[model samples]
Each structure stands twice: as C-alpha cells, then as structure tokens.
Target chain A: MRSYKDIHNILLDRIKGGEWEPGALVPSEADLAREFGCTRVTVNRAMQALADSGLIERRRKAGTRVVQRMTRNAVFEIQLVRHEIEQRGGTYKYLLISRSEEKPPQKVRAEMGLSGDNALLHVISLHFADGAPYQLEDRWISLDTVTQARREPFDAISPNEWLLREIPYTNAEHVFRASRAEPMDAEFLNLGEGEPVFVIERTTWLSDAAVTHVRLVHPADSFRLVTRDQHGTAL
Target chain B: MRSYKDIHNILLDRIKGGEWEPGALVPSEADLAREFGCTRVTVNRAMQALADSGLIERRRKAGTRVVQRMTRNAVFEIQLVRHEIEQRGGTYKYLLISRSEEKPPQKVRAEMGLSGDNALLHVISLHFADGAPYQLEDRWISLDTVTQARREPFDAISPNEWLLREIPYTNAEHVFRASRAEPMDAEFLNLGEGEPVFVIERTTWLSDAAVTHVRLVHPADSFRLVTRDQHGTAL
Candidate 1:
C-alpha cells in the first residue's frame, strides 16, 4: 500500500514532469492500481483530495484535467465600512442626504417581525472614499429599540459604525444581487440609469427584536463582493 | 403603562397618518415622553425600536427625519445548476473539453499550500442546460491525493455534482468579480473578448487540508448569481 503522502508526491511528480500534460487523458484507476500495487480506494482518496484542493479536475465519466485561469478562488472578508475604504488608501466620508419618520415598508416590516404600520426612522446617505462615490446607503432604523439615535447628526458619522459600537444587534440577514441604476440613482451615483450596480441588503436585530435594515448600492464595475467558506461550510 | 404592542401601534398611527412625513423631523424625546405619558426610557425604547426597523431615519445633531429613497433593495437567490436547466424545461448536457496530468503551477501551489510541481489532474468542461450553451468549468485536482483520477471520464456527469455527493468538503471560499472575457473564453462562453462577464472563483478545503479549487465562468448577460441572508448578517 502506498502512504498517503506517497500518493500525493508520485502524482505530483507525473504532472510536473509532463508525463501527464495539460489537456491530456490520464491513465485509469485500474491501471494505476496495477502499476502501484495499491487499492483503487487509495487512488480514489488521493484523487478526490486533489480535486478538492483545486489541483486537478474530475468528472463522472469524462476524466480529470488541469485548469488555466486568470484568477483563482479568492476568499473575501466582509469589511466594516470605515475599514473598507482605508484599506484602499482613501479617506472615508459620509453624507446625510435625508432622514424621516414613517411607517415601515411592508417588506421591512415582514423581515423585522413588525406588525402593520410600525413607525420607523429612515436615513439616506452616501459613503465616499477619496472623494469618489463608494456606496449609497439607504436605511431604516427602528426607533423602538435604540434610544441614542434621536440626538445624533448623521452628518459627522454613519449609523452602521455607530450601531456597531453602541448597539448590540442579536441577529442579521443579508441579500446580494446585481441590477441597473435608475434615473435618480444614476444622478446620485454619477452614472447612467442603465449602468450595472451591486446591491446588498441587510437587516439586524437586537436579540429577537429587529434593530435596523439597510440597502447599500455600489458600482458593479468598480468593486467586487467576497465571501469565504470551508468547502461546503461557510466561513 | 402602555403595552409594548400599544406603544408600537400608537407610534405607527402617527407616522402613517402623516403626523410625521418624509423629510419632516420627529418630535423630541421629551415631547414624546409627555405625549405617551410613559417614562423617558419607554419612549426611548419605542423610538429606538422604530429606528432599527427602518421605519424612520436617525442622525446625531440632525435628530430624526423621514427618509427619501432613490433605490430599494432587491434580493435574488443563487440557483443550483439542475434547478436552473429544468426550469427552462431543457435537457442538461455535459461535455468534456480536456484532461491532463501535470505539476501544479506556482500560483496554484501558493493557494493550495503545496511546494513546487505537485502532481495534479486537470479538467475543462462545458455545461449546457436545455441543450444550449450554458457555462464553462475549468478545474484542477491534486493527483497526489486521488490516485484514481488518472482514469475517470467526465463526459456525462459534472465533476462538481459528483464531488458534492461523493466527498464532503469542510470549507469553501468564493469571490465574484466582473471582467472582460478574452478570445478563448469568449469562444467557449460565446462572448467576445472585452465583453463583460461575471466570474466566480472557488476553493474548497477539507478540515485543514486543501481539497480542490475551481473557476467557473458565466456569460454575464446569460444569468444572474444570487445569495440571500434574512438579517443584516451575510449568509
């Protein structure tokens, strides 16, 4: 029986030595088992492990091959707003566009587990990094859960950063999608209405109580959204 | 004392009844305290809760104002491949492009935690759902881990679907980006180079060991990728 490491090394040698070149068919497991005098299961395990590691490709009956790509799998971390921009060597800026008191939107109410016409505090703003529009955040705050919100001027800071520090949200939900900007959105984002954008929507809770819901829009051409998982498991 | 539900209902009545309109500021906490005949903290709780629900907007020095929105968030769930094709009532087809055995490239090594020239099994494939061109999958597997890879044929079934059932992976990392497709990629995906494409790169790990890495390219105009989280938290 070949040691696990032995399987890894010998296979790697064949590939690197060009015995098995890119786009070339490989020998069958039966053949390898015959040549190495090992069990097919061991060969299967090694190959499965390799395929999992992104070293080679496997299919039902088509066989495995090499991948040539300009980009590999990249793990992305969700960033706090301030950190999101500073990492780019750009200054962060927040602008308060508008604010109001109104009934919660139906979807927001449903997501927050609120009954009909729940009063909500709504805030609209834009986030800029280095003088360029980075994100347009349109949000609704639950006046019922947060006390300090009444006295704050969002002009100097963002609700997200503030909530992270002062409020402890017990839960949250997030949604991501791609769409085009509208006419008003076009002007605000400095692009045409039909231009593509990346949109992220989030709802936070204070324990079982819903806290805040926000929709953030960013130019799709300019940025990418990233998330990482452990194979099938989320990171 | 007013029941929490009562507090929520009363506040909602005032907002929707136009007692507080969009862009119009809300009453002071002290005023609300007087009107509700509740303790300042109770009023605070209600207001805070409302803000959290996205029913209203809050600011530091600016107080609370009704929100005016230029955009509303839309959520889309990324669909599984099988569901995608069957939805169109088309028979899904799989084709093997190429397969080979070779040493892992330097970049692949860096990402996979391997040192020079590890043997690998590589495969490239085209997926057609409903008998039409759908996607192009480029993959790499480590020959060292799965020695049987030398013999597998991927013609009828996909490596992704196969691996999902046969091997359980512990971790995965994903990245989504927009890029212009090159000539070869365009030919495969049926798009011209410099045409925008939505690219997703994925890497999987089993426990601490790297298992597989894959790059899936989709024509941007062909379909949309979606993921959903219910709370403010990303799923």
Candidate 2:
C-alpha cells in the first residue's frame, strides 16, 4: 500500500542520486525487501516497475543489472522514410493513389476496438525514393476515431502526413513480418510472382482504442534493414 | 585509458545503486569530466555510451534524464521450428522440399560478404502446424563457411534444425514487412495472388561474418504478431 509507494520513491531517489549507476547490479528481491522492511512481493513489484521503465535488464540466473546506454532504443527511430531515402542517395517522394470507404475486416475491427461492422476510410498510395518504387502503403482508418479523416483527400497528401495532421494519437502498435508478392502487389510494386517482399504493418491508437492500421510493403530485392548492436553483454 | 573502462563500470554502478533514478537529469559533460578527472571527451564517450545503452534519455534542450524502460527489448527469441510449433498448441512437423548449390546472386553475395561470385547451398523447406501450411522457408547457406552440407538427405530433417546442430551462430538480424501475394508465393501460402502477406527476413552470423540468410512469408489474415508490453503502454 503506501509502503510500496514509499519503497518506489526510495528506489527512485537512489537511482536519481547516482547510487545505482547504469550497468550496476542492485540488491536481490530478498535483500531489497529486508532493507525496506516490506514483503518480497512489494519489492518485486517496485523492481519490476523499474525494469519495465527500461532502467534495468533482468536475467534468469544472472539476476538483474542496469543496462548500458549504448544498448538503448532502436538507433534510427522507426526508419523515417526521409532518412531511408537519403541513405540511398535518392530524393523521397510520396503519392496518395486513392481513398475509399469500406467495412474493416474482423482483425482490424478487433485491433481498432470497433464495436460494429463499421466502415473505414481506406487509402492506397506509393512511396518513391529517387523516383523508384520504395513502398506501397495500404491503410485503413477508423472514422470513428478521427472524424476529420472523412473529409481529407489523401491524394494530394501522404497518408502518414494526413494522419499526423488530422489525428492526435496516444500510442502505436507495430508488427513486422514477411510474405510472398501478390499479382496486384507486384504490379504496384513492380515485382514478379514468387518474388519476396518485406512488409511492415503499424497500428496507432488513442489509449485502449485503436486508430489506424497501415501496411507498408517493399520488394525484397529492393530494401535493406540495418541496426547497430552492442557486442553481446547487454543483460 | 584504463579509466575509460572504469568509467562505464562507474556510471552503471551509480544507476543500479539508485542514485540515478528514472527520469532524473544527469550531470553536464563538463561536470562529469571534472568529477572523473578525465578529458571531456572521455566523459562524453561514457555518457554517450550510456545514452546509447538506453539508461538515460538525452535531447538537445531536454538535457539528459534517466530513461524508463518502455520498450525493454521485447527480445523475441524466435525459436527453431520445432519450438515454435510445440508452443503453438499443435504437433510439430517439418519437410525439406529441395536443396542445391547455386551461384549466389550479386546482392545475396554482398549480404554474405563473399568475394566475387560464389556458389551457395540453397535450402528450401516447409513446416506444418496440424498438417496445414505453416511456413515456406527459403534459405541460402555459405558453402565456404559450413562444410557439413555437401551430403545428407534433409527430407526428414530441416535446415533450421541442421543449422542449430552443425553451425554455431553468434548473431542474428531480423526484419518484417508486408507484400501482395504472387502466384508461387500465393500457391505455397494458400492465398490469392492479390492477397496481402507478411514477410520476415533474418540473417544469421558466425562471429562477424554472415553464415546464412532466410526469408519467411506467411498469409497475412492467418495470424498476428503477439507480444505483451512491459509498460502500461499501448502499442
């Protein structure tokens, strides 16, 4: 109860005081509980909360240790389309192909937390890096979440920009997976059948309510994903 | 300098000791340098490294503050096929469809960091979940890296299994994207040519060099990538 909150504050105070530096091992659950004069579960809850905040790394046998800063967040920040284009030495361009209304599928309905068989504003477009095919984006928008979307013409603007302008979002869920090239996908993406393609699907939300679900696909032969890693030693 | 190593150790020590709690601002470069009795570059290196490790958040104007672990490295240990299947509430099954050596493509050769044009042991296979098309995997192995391949009927065994047994890997990089289904990709995945699919590509390394690359594509509507957030965060 209040003791746990006090424990949390004490723990935060110690960390802020630089007593437990990054990559340093803290006391075990038992040790923490005994020192704080509280049950182990309370200590466990505090430590778990700290770990969830990205302050420490937990290992089964090695116990928990603070993480080094070098191992932090995806270095590039979610692969901004602009940086990706510049890296290829190409000027990035975007075009909104079309926008239409349709009922969302079961998954989108559930993911977006839509109650009824609600209709969504679907936007399709192409992204080009140096005047070449970069990504084919097909997105479904929940009009209930963002009413402004119903009036926007996605053609003159990219769906990304359009969404960012018209909607204020709280969180986003992302999923990346691979799949084979479909004929329509191939025609839009300029690939042959049986060809491999890279796909990234992202869903943005406002609290527990989902907002937009977008699928961005790239021809496998045309894209590369890069990230820097610390040479093992991250807890 | 020997102090540089001690610097990382010390910084980590303070954080774990609770002196640098989550969201607490850190000392400036000049101040840290003065404290460590090292060059500003050394402190910069240390703090930069700390920031990189995700122990602290830094912005031009916001200064540096202890970061909470929002992401917490959802370290998905994508298991071997057997493990993936076993976890899926189904009987695990694997089949090796084809194998051969081919002159690796220019891009693939580059990915493998191979010199000039080289032949690669191409392994193709399919795994089943309850006798349904679970996954269609296409993999390319560096012949020069692993010698155990020149012989064996992989029909009963899987390349994923063989790789784990015969090859020792030190690192792996994964990417996911979405694409339209092609005829072959559609047929194998049991989807229409225009259907969307999820694709994941993984490159495995033995030490610093790549040993193999694999591409996995799944029917989009069939499944969703599942993960729980460590933060009370959505997305």
Candidate 3:
C-alpha cells in the first residue's frame, strides 16, 4: 500500500517537474485517488501537506491549484518581557509610567476594529533588564471586552502579563518595523532622539472581540529576532 | 469518552490552577493513563499537545513537567521581493549592482560555517517597485555547493529567483533587526546615512552544507512585516 508520505513525495516531484503549471488546477482528490490506486483520504492528506507548505491552494468549491508564488513562513516567538530578560540572565523589572482610560487615537481605534467613542485603557510602561532600560510599551486595552481591567491597578503587574493570565485570545496580529525613537522611547529606552529602533505592534482578540493592542519599542542595537528551522517542510 | 482534546483542556486547567508548579514534574504517561482511565497513547497525545503549546516539557526518561515561561510564536510569511511589490500593485524591477567571486568577509564566512579561504559568489543587487528603490540585497552563494553558479551570468535573472528555481534547501534561518544605513546602503537606496532601515538576514542550508547567506535591507518608512492569525493554536 502506498503511504501518504509516498504520495506526498510523488506529488511534490510532479510540481517540481512542471507537470502542472503555476495557477493550474491539479486533479481532484477523488481523481488522484483513482490514479494512484489509494483511498481518497490518503490523497487528501498528501494534498493538505502540499497546501500547508505553500505550494498549492485548495478552495471549498474550486479545485486545488499550484500556487503562483512559493512563499515560506518564518516563525518568531513572542516572549514575555520578564521571561526574555530572565532568559538572558538579567533581572527583570517592570515600571508603570502612566495609565488612563480615554478614547484611543483614530489609527489605534481602527486597527483594533473599535467603533466611535469607545474609551480604552491606555497604558505606557517600561521594562528593565538588570537596571537598564530595555523596552518601552505603549498599550491600549479594550475595556469593553476586558471589563475587569478597569477596576484593577496595573502598578505591580503589566497589562501584557495580566491579560495573558486572565484572558485567552483566539487571534493575534503582529507587525514588525523600524522607526526613529520617539521622545517617550528616547527617554525610557535611554536612546538619543532620532536613533533607529525596532518596534513590534501586536493586536490580540478573543474570538471576534478585540482584547488589546500594544507597541513594544527597543533600542536598535540591543535586540534582534532570530528563528531557525531544521526541516524544509517545517514553518 | 475522554478524547485527547478533553484531556488537553483538563491538563491546561491543572497547569493554570497551579496543580503542578513551574518546573515541577507532572505524572508520567503511564500514571496519568491510570488516573484518567485511558490508554497511555491517549494521555501521551494530550501531553504532546501541551508541550507543543509551550506549556510543558517532555524529556526522555525524565517524564513531563510544566514550563516556566509561556511563549507563543508569531508567523511571518517570507515573500519574494518581486511578488511583494507586485502584490501591492506596483511593477517590480531588478537591477544587478555588481557580482564577483571573492573570499567572503570573516563574518560571512563564520555565518556560513566556512573556515578560512572559501571564495564565494557575492552578488549585490537592488530591487525596485514602480521606479522607486525598494530593497538592497547583498547575497553570498556558496560556489562549493552551487558549482553551476560559477558559469552563470546573473544579468537577466536575480540570484534570488535563480537559486529558488535551481536549488532545494533543507534548513534555513531568518533574522530580523534594525540598523542605521551604511554609506553603501545610503547611496543605493537613496537614503540618508543615519536613516533607520529594516534589515533581514537569512541563511539556507542543504542538510549540513550551507547554500547561501543574504542580507536584505529596506527603507524604514516604506516597508513593514505583518502577519495575522485567525486561530489561537496557529504559530
């Protein structure tokens, strides 16, 4: 009996061999099963593996087709500030700079998918590694979804830590960019104004409800995100 | 019937409830199987789920334990620069700055795991979108492995596109960071010397043999990497 791995390799070879051109529809699972003399389930498994590897696209009604562009995913782990610092053998510290409930800026509101006139809990904080400023966090929490955050004081615990412990987010978006240090970042991260800084903006949601949107800034020379994959098929 | 998912949820609750403290060993698969009145295979599946979620660690002969740090992965798709520009509704252009076979810098050598005098094909190129400078690519191809590169003149096609079509790599690494533009970057990218830029360094290997190492620099204001996940369990 031909295993799924064998089918996967055979299909991969066909793709590499240009048997099906890019964007061209491949045979249906049922057709492929008959051609390979295997069960449909086995063919489906092989097709799913190809889809996951970014080589093919499968739609509900449309048949499976070769992807026009072969894109690969790079995975970066989102670590807690405390854990990141402690993992580097540095003592971690958190300090709250400011906290207020107000209508977030229009950009943030739109990014969080919030409507008009909704006040979110805005917070600014600094993370320290061994008494040196590390990251400056600017955050806006959706009080409508996380109602308990309104009553809790974030003096001891960061919103990041608290939210992770209290709420389970079903979706998240992360954006990475480079920008000049803002005044607040310059002061908190102890960097000269206009210096390059790495910024990570993240938004998390619990189902359809927005939970939090945060921007973490670090001095450019201090941090880098690295990921390694041992297998070609692994993301 | 106690499915793996049901067991997974119960174990997650136990971890959240502090039934097993961080770094504290949890019961082995055999023990948990007896308590839950299920087969060891079912319990093992649940434990694997927890481990994959960064909530637990499984060691050979040492049993399983709760993790001290909870980390989540953020996945960013690595798209071809040409595809990225085209996806944004711009005409993509490629310009070959220079190409030569020379001994790479010590840093490049170290990164590629090459010792002493290994002459590699160094290709510097610029990618443009709609007549605007987009990204500067500095690449080093291991001629030892990609021996055919020595005979090819990369005038009509970029090394990136050529290699992707020609070779298959089994392992890869990606690093993202920020940096001030060097003079070469400033001259090619039409940016100020001190301007901040987003940089991506990537290396690919065929099993243990290095294939290529590349650094891609983009103007800070023009590019940002974004990824969104709909499911909580996705990396």
- The 10-residue segment with the lowest total lDDT in model 1 chain B: B69-78
lDDT of 1: 0.66
Q: What range of 10 consecutive residues in model 3 chain A has the weakest lDDT sum?
A: A226-235
User: After superposing candidate 2, which stretches have Cα over 4 Å from the reference?
Assistant: A1-77, A97-107, A116-125, A132-136, A142-157, A162-171, A175-199, A217-235, B1-77, B96-109, B115-126, B132-157, B165-168, B175-201, B215-235
lDDT tens digits, residue span A14-50, model 3: 7765687778899999999999899998899788777
Over A1-235, each residue of candidate 2 has an lDDT whose tens digit, in order, gives 4475677667765664457765688888889888877899888767765675455678876888865542222221344565568766889888878789998788877776678888899998998988878899889988887778888887777877666544544456666555667786788888886566776677777656667998888886677555433222232
Q: Model 1: runs farther than 4 Å from truth?
A: A1-78, A87-90, A102-114, A227-235, B1-122, B126-135, B165-171, B178-198, B205-211, B218-235
The DockQ-based order of candidates, best leading, equals 3, 1, 2
lDDT, candidate 1, B127-187, per-residue tens: 8866666777888876655555666776776776655433444456666665556676788
TM-score of chain A of each: 0.65, 0.66, 0.81
The TM-score of predicted model 2 comes to 0.54
Candidate 3 positional error at A196, Å: 0.5
The digit string of per-residue lDDT tens for model 2 on B82-118 reads 7777777888788777899898777777666677577
lDDT at position B21, candidate 3: 75
Docking class of 3: acceptable
Chain A vs. native, model 3, TM-score: 0.81
Top-down lDDT ranking? 3, 2, 1
TM-score of chain B taken alone, every candidate: 0.62, 0.69, 0.79
Residue B170, candidate 2: Cα error in Å is 3.3
- Given the true complex, what DockQ would model 2 score? 0.09
